[model samples]
Each structure stands twice: as structure tokens, then as C-alpha cells.
Target: MLKFFSEEIDFKLPFPQKTSKWIKTISESEGYNIISLNYIFCTDDYLLEINKQYLDHDYYTDIITFDNSEEEGKIESDIYVSVDRVKENAETFGADFEVEMRRVLIHGLLHLMDYTDTSEELKLQMRAKEDECLLLF
Candidate 1:
């Protein structure tokens, strides 16, 4: 199952049903099944506190993912996104707000599929995968 939520923010995610279906399609294509997935939308400050309290990072970020799967091929997690950051990122990248937001959304799912962006090479690959997934939508 996939769900979208807003916490401490007045933003509503666009096309929740389509987004959830796309996420499920990506997960199944990557050989995993979704047990449960939640997307939490909030402001930059709200997400910054989560980053600090949980990740020990003081910087503001676009997304924070908490993976909760106890076994392989299963996904259960909470993904927090900053709508404030998404808007800025959209402008920074010259992309539409919804496009950038969906990228951030799927980026978290890609991580659960064993994709990492810790290095430059890995980041490139991750970006390619994200692009490919975006095209599928």
C-alpha cells in the first residue's frame, strides 16, 4: 500500500492516486513488493528538525527516507519530503515543481531497491534510474 500525507504544512500532493500507482509499478518492476509506504510532506523547517533529530544532520534537505523492511524483496518505510525544498529545487533545476517532487518521491524507493548515490558514479547511475522511472510515468 502507498499513502500520501501532509504534516505541519498546508500543501496537498497533486494526483495522489496516480502517484501511488506509479510508485507501485516502479517497485514491482524493481522486484520488490510494497508492504507499506508513506509519503509525508512538510516544510523545510519541519523536515530539518527530523534530519537533526534522526539523522544528526543540521542541514535542510529535500527528502528523508526511513527504511523499515525486515527482509529482502519487501518495502516498508516513511519518506518525508520538504515541499519548500521541492519548489526551490524545481526552480534551481529548471524543472516543473511536480516533476521535481516526483523525482524526490521515487528517489527514496530506489534506495530501498538497493540503489545508492554515495559516490559520484553511483549518483550518476541513480539519476539515470530516476530519469528512466520518470519517463515511465
Candidate 2:
């Protein structure tokens, strides 16, 4: 199941069904089944508080993913996305808002699939994967 929620932000996802189906397809392609996933959208301040409280990081990030997958080939997670950050990133990168938003969404899912970006090389790989996934959109 895929669910979307908002915290201190008045927002609605454009296409819930289509987005969920796409995410499911991505998970299946990575050899994992979606157990349950929640996408929580919030303002920068709200997400920053969450970062401080949960991760002890006092910084603004586009998304923070909490993995809850219990078994192999299963994916469960809470992906918190900061709408404010997404908008800013879109402008900074000269990309469309919807396109950047989709990238961030898939980026969180990639994290749950065991993709990391701690290094520049890995970040490049992650970006390539995100671009490929975006083509499916």
C-alpha cells in the first residue's frame, strides 16, 4: 500500500493511483515487494524539526527515508519530503517542479532499495538511476 499525507502543508498529490502504480513497478523491478509505504509532505520547518528529533541532524533536506522492511525482497518505509525544499531545488536546478518532485520521490524509494550516495561516485550513480526511472514517468 502507498499512502500520502501532509504535515503543516496544504498540498495534494496530482495522481495518487498512477504514482502508486509507478512506485510499485519500480520496487518489483528491484526484486522487492511493497509492503506499505507512507509519503509525508511537509514544509521546510516541519521537516527540519523531524530531522533534528529523529536523526539529530539540524539541517534542511529534501527527503528523509525511514526503512522498515523486515524481510528480504520486501520494502516498507516512511518517506518525509519537504515541499519547500523541492520548490527551491527546482528553481536552483532550472527544472520543472513536477519533474523535480518525481525525482525526489524516486530517490527516496531508491534509498529503501539499498542505494547510497555518501560518495560522489555513488551520488552520480544514484542520479543516473533517478534519470532512468524518470523516463518511465
Q: Model 1, residue 39: what's the lDDT?
A: 93
**Per-residue lDDT of candidate 1, residues 42-90 (tens digit):** 9999999999999999999999999999999999999999999999999
Evaluate all candidate structures by whole-model CA lDDT and list the values in order.
0.95, 0.94
lDDT of model number 2: 0.94
Instruction: Give the 10-residue window scoring lowest on summed lDDT in candidate 1.
Output: 11-20
- Residue 109 miss distance in model 2 (angstroms): 0.2
Residue 132 of model 2 has an lDDT of 94
> What does the lDDT read for residue 26 in candidate 2?
92
Top candidate on lDDT is 1
Model 2: per-residue Cα lDDT over 22-90, one tens digit each: 989999999989899999999999999999999999999999999999998898899999999999999
